[model samples]
Target: MRLYTIETGFFKLDGGAMFGVVPKSLWQRTNPADERNLCTWTNRLLLIEDGNQLILVDTAIGDKQDEKFFSHYFLHGDATLDGSLAKYGFHRDDITDVILTHLHFDHCGGAIKRDGERLLPAFKNARFWSNEKHWEWAINPNPREKASFLRDNILPIQESGQLHFIKDGEPFSPNIDIRYAYGHTESMMLPQICYQGKTILYMADLLPSVGHIPLPYVMGYDVRPLTTMEERQHYWQEIVDNEYILFLEHDPINACCTLQHTEKGVRLKETFRLEDMFG
Candidate 1:
């Protein structure tokens, strides 16, 4: 099996929203904000090449949105989804599966593209994977999350007849297991991949960055903040016990990290690029 880090690009979000109740004095020390208090974050995706199946986890915000819509996020970076795939000698058509952890615009917007007046699946030949629960929640989003779940980023997969769901505890592949967390959004799926003699968990929103490892650092964007805290407590132990390598999705700098048990609680032990571990 082979793995590659697909960086789509970076965008900015209000630091206060990302860190929830954590004070600026603390989070800012790690993820320093710009003049407008917006912190830069990377939309990092994961690509898995096992045998003939090429699976991609999450597609960053695409270039389909209008300039007015994009101005708010301040999307800026050199990386792109297609460019990143080409870097690994692949193309959009090469992907067999696209596992959308959730339907938030930043995470799944690139799954579809604007072609004339029609919206189409970006990966023409891939099966778009999203759970039944999350699928329903996103399509009929509540007021709190409606803005993040853009119809342009979703709806097209199901319309294209390429949508599929993997139940909790189900295996997406021989080496990949699906774990569901309801804290961030309803039934947000996190892929637990066993690779290179280590288990790597895709920390999709569940733990956006190493700075969020602390129990109280839950994001204000989460629908259920208390649920998020409980979920974090449950997973932090497993992360420490199994010594899992956490593949961060939105961390601006770090790509991966391992956890260590400290007197306070589980904290980041070491950080490195994914290649450093596999190469």
Candidate 2:
């Protein structure tokens, strides 16, 4: 089994929103903000190459949104989903499975594409995976999260008859296991993989970056902030105990990180590129 890091691109989000109630004075040190208070973040995705299956975890924000819609988030960087796939001698068509961490636009936007006047699945051969409960929650979104769950980036997968769900505690692949967290969103799936003699947990939005390692540094966008903190506390201890590597989705600079139990709490021990570990 092998893993590849897929770089979709970078975009800006309000630092305050990303760090929740954590004051700018603290989070700004790690994720410095621009003049407009927007912090740059990368849509880093994971591609699992295990035997016949090539599974992609979380597609980044696709380029289908109009200029007005994109102006809100300053999308930058030359890296694109296609370009990154090509770098590894792969293409969208090669992906056999797509595991959406949740239905958020940034996480699943690239799952679908604009084909002339029709919206279609980007990876024609891939089965887009999203749990039934989260699927229902996303389609009938609450007022707070309605904006994040864009219908254009979603509905098309079901319309195309390619949508699949990972049952609770079910095995996704020979080496991958599905772990669910509800703080960020209902039934947010985090793929935990046993690769290269190490355990790697995909930290979707439950833990965005190394900077968000602190217990109270939960994102404001989470529907249940307290639950997020509780989840973090539970996961942090387990990660430290087992020495698991975390695959960060939104960290601009770091691809993977490990945690250590420190006096303050479980803090980031080291951050490195994915290749450094497997290659």
Candidate 3:
């Protein structure tokens, strides 16, 4: 099996929102904010190539939104979904499966695209994979998360007849296993993979960056902040004990990292690019 890091580009978000209760004095040291108090973050996706299967983990925010809608996020960067795929000699049409971690706009927006007046599945030939629980929650989103779960970014896969759900205890692929966390959003699916004699856990919002390694650095966007803390406690220890590599989705600089049992609980042991490990 081979894994490739697909960088869709970067966008900015209020640093305060990204790092829940953590003070700017603390988080700014690591994720320094711009004059507007917004911190730039990368929308990094993962691609898996195994035998006859070519699977994409997540799609970053797409270009379908109006300029007024995008003005708030300040999306900037040269990399794009199609460009990143072509970098690995692959294309959206080459993807056989698309595993959505959650239906948040920034994560799943690229799954669909704007074609004239119709919104459609961006990967027409691929089966879009999402859990049943998340699927239901996103379609009928609560007020707290309604903005993040845009109907344009979702619903199209189901309408296109290409949506599939991963059942509990059911394996999606021989080398991949689905791990769920409810704090970030209902049943957010984290893809854990066994590759190159090491395990890589895709940290989708559960742990956005190395700066969020501390126990209290949960995102303000999380619906259940306390549950997020609990989930982090469990995963942090497990990652350290088993020496697992964490594949970060929104970290601006680091694509992957490892944790260790430090004097101050689990802390970042090392940070490096995914290509540094597999390329």
lDDT of 3 at 204: 96
RMSD of each: 0.7, 0.7, 0.7
The TM-score values for the models, in the order shown, are 0.99, 0.99, 0.99
Give each model's whole-structure lDDT: 0.94, 0.94, 0.93
The collision pairs in model 1 are: none
Summarize candidate 2's per-residue lDDT along 131-167 as a digit string, tens digits.
9999999999999999999999889999999999889
Worst ten-residue run, lDDT, model 3? 259-268
* Model 3 lDDT per residue over 71-186, tens place: 99999999988999999899899999999999999999999989999999999889999989999999999999999999988888899999999997787888999999999999
Q: What TM-score would candidate 1 get against the native?
A: 0.99
Whole-model alpha-carbon lDDT for candidate 2: 0.94
What candidate 2 gets wrong by more than 4 Å, as runs, is: none
Model 1 Cα lDDT, one tens digit per residue, 1-279: 999999988999999999999999999988999899999999999999999999999998888999999999999989988899999999999999999999999899989989999999999999999998999999999999999999888888899999998876679989999998998999999999999899999999999998899999999999999999999999999999999999999999999999999999889899999999889
Model 2 residue 274 lDDT score: 95
Error of 2 at 253 (Å): 0.6
Judge candidate 1 against the unseen true structure and give its global Cα lDDT, from 0 to 1.
Answer: 0.94
